[model samples]
Target: MKFNESLFDNEQTRKEFLQTTSALLISLSALSLLHCSEEAPQKPSKNLNWITTKPEKRPVMNVAYSPTRILLKNGIIIDGSGKPPFTGDVMINGSTIEIITPKQINFKGTTIDCTDKIIAPGFIDAHSHLDWILPLDGHPELKNPFMEQGITTTVTGNCGYGVAGFMPKSKYLAFIKNIGKGFFSGDSSTQKDKFVQKLAVSLTSMQQYLSYCRQHGIPMNMANLAGHGTTRMSLRGYESKPLDKDEMKTMLYHLEQAMDEGAYGVSFGLQYEPGIFATNDEIAEIAKLVKKKDKIVTCHMKAYSALSGTYPLKPFGTPHNIIAINEMIDIAKQTDIRLQLSHLIFVGTKTWKTCPQALSIIDKAIDSGLDVQFDTYAYHCGTSVINVFFPSSFLAQTPQIYEDKVALLKLRAQLELIVALLGFGYNDIQIINANNPELAKFNGK
Candidate 1:
């Protein structure tokens, strides 16, 4: 059920799932290419002394390194500031690049011989889901997938599904239980249910998560966005309903806390559950809070379903891509918040041919004084939850509630709609994986 490219490139897949996209093209001739060390350098542990003592006394690394002079000789340097490549020697004093010149420099400490290799600043992964990936995989010391690719920093917690605040234990239990039903599986059974069950229970807040990363020694730096979906879940428990005044206040408080703790901004996965239930006004209210902090707002707009003309199931004209974009633009216009359109891409035949028109819309927005930006990958296929196409009514019910006769009948109807919306035969609907013994046989059929 995954739309390979869409899901991977989508904003908050990390909250529900993680995706991998293979780049098919490389711009080797580009003047600026990222280069990084093979591994992270060793630094004295700062928090080890407080491990068993008062946790409040634990020291976290928050300062830059003192000046240390090192020189690189004879390298092709491309300073990522869009400058042309030049052959030179670069000097580093402490954390800053002191100079880059063609002249030879006599220096103390280490001098690396770089006759052909490119020297450039580390790459910044503008978006990622490492917040959930690192904790789940327990590989903070070796974030090699990114490190090896020259990625020196990552901004995570995108798509309103961050791991910042805590959820009530009961809600956490229910969420975990629901995912175990294999509703989240991908190309394989994944058995994420077993993994989720085994995950250490202490990962409840963003601060604690970051502390874990620092304690484990992450190879790269990390930043975060407060997740709107997680906040909604914490308050409403996937009820698929609007928030009352008090609930909204609580959510705002959580967002404020996350921002004070260093969240760069906020994110929304309006295409998914909880967020899907959020009204335009509700989204605006949240974005207003983000604007108060003078931070950006990222959104996975409620566009695709509306564009496909399959959603608003009973109520047509429920804001498609153009409307969704306008809504975000309007929010930004009203609040003066920077807007980031997460993983912008055109989907389906209905929208694919209109790529030029889409770009024109964005261009017009920029011309109109709106601060808008977007990110995308070269891949075409996207991935998403198989149940995404399922109607909201079916989604609102808990897995336990779906075992009844009426619920089973509803499930059949929902499946039929999904098939019709897909407008494809069984061959196109390849079975990725299924937990049910009866359904597993259809894998790859």
Candidate 2:
């Protein structure tokens, strides 16, 4: 049909045209519009004559500044608050932002011309794991990769793995050493050795660890959480049962101390050992204290299993992720603790599509006056030690199981179960690394 093309002049007309078109013609029209849209406005050159009459001369200012103030002139300032960006000059006195104004202000200080630059606060990585990064060789400035992405603050000690607050007990240390000996191909002896030697003498508590991080001149600001797994280990060793009365007391005491020493909150890796074994009563005990102190409880809920759809063994019941979220919300309901759901996810084809419903559940809890928050990783996959998927008892016996044929068989059976549950064949699982030469063949398998 012959058409008046000017009907596409405005968005309303465009929509009408889209509705009247055949599918094949609509596709062609979309391609045509896409091609037309690819022409972007050309950026003006930095040395454009409108801004200057002559070629720019080399800057003559000294590379040093004696004044404790800095003036950033003529830039688009987006102050990190949700406010819209605007052109302004920002003045900093010492380390604090003293002023942001569109009008001229007289100031005797270093001036930086930010003609086309954007001035905004550094980004914050709300979930981070820096335990390994902090101990890496040569003390390379922290977060090189993250820095490239403009992140300047990191909240570490996430997912129940932290570097400090609990002493590396002799028995735990031996297990670590055994893992280093290739029982678990992922452990690095050198990395563990470095962490041990650096903190062995001076680091005893969360306060000490924070102090150590401060003293080390780490490039970015760091906030930490006291991990539930480490706290359980400190008090109950590698046991996978509920904490007894005295043991509970000790755990509570340490958590209180860590919060007082500047921990932002507490985190739990419920899918991992010891944390998975904590009873509802035990969790409530800790949540109560965190609520009392007005801190947060960040939990990686106990909903996930070795296989995506399988339920965790009882005491930690499961129908799915919804139950896990409800368990977390219940803590906030019972104790009024501020809750932060760490890495919230609904995996597997059966459950993955229910993310919106899961979120609605959280929203319903929030509507009922609970303090709830959540954060998630940006990527599609995650990394962890393979032992993380095993039962707590098996985890406790990892060192011995490596050499015991019966234990090895049991482990094999457990792995088979995981493979079946997750619907993974042998080729689906690839060892990240197997440092030992004898096991190198398994690395890419």
Instruction: Give me the candidate number with maximum lDDT.
Output: 2
How many clashes in each structure?
Answer: 10, 0
Question: In order, what lDDT does every prediction score?
Answer: 0.60, 0.61
Those runs of model 2 whose alpha carbons end farther than 4 Å from true positions after fitting are: 1-69, 102-117, 135-142, 167-195, 200-202, 304-319, 391-431, 434-445
The TM-score values for the models, in the order shown, are: 0.69, 0.70
Candidate no. 1 TM-score: 0.69
Candidate 1's C-alpha runs over 4 A off are: 1-74, 93-96, 104-116, 135-142, 167-170, 173-201, 305-310, 313-319, 397-445
Tens-place lDDT per residue, model 1, 1-445, is: 3233332232433322211111111101111111113456688654433212232332332222334767776676777988666656777887888777655666656678876666889988877766655544443343666788788888887777766664545355355334323322331333353334432245545566567667766557888888888767777668877889998888888788778777888999877677777888888898888888999888887764324322444323432556667777887778777889887765543344456656777888889998899886544444444444445555666454444545544544554443354332222333444434444554443
RMSD of 1: 13.8
Q: What lDDT tens digits, residue by residue, belong to model 2 across residues 227-329? A: 7776676565567667789889888887888889988878887876667778889899999888888888888887543243124433223445677888889
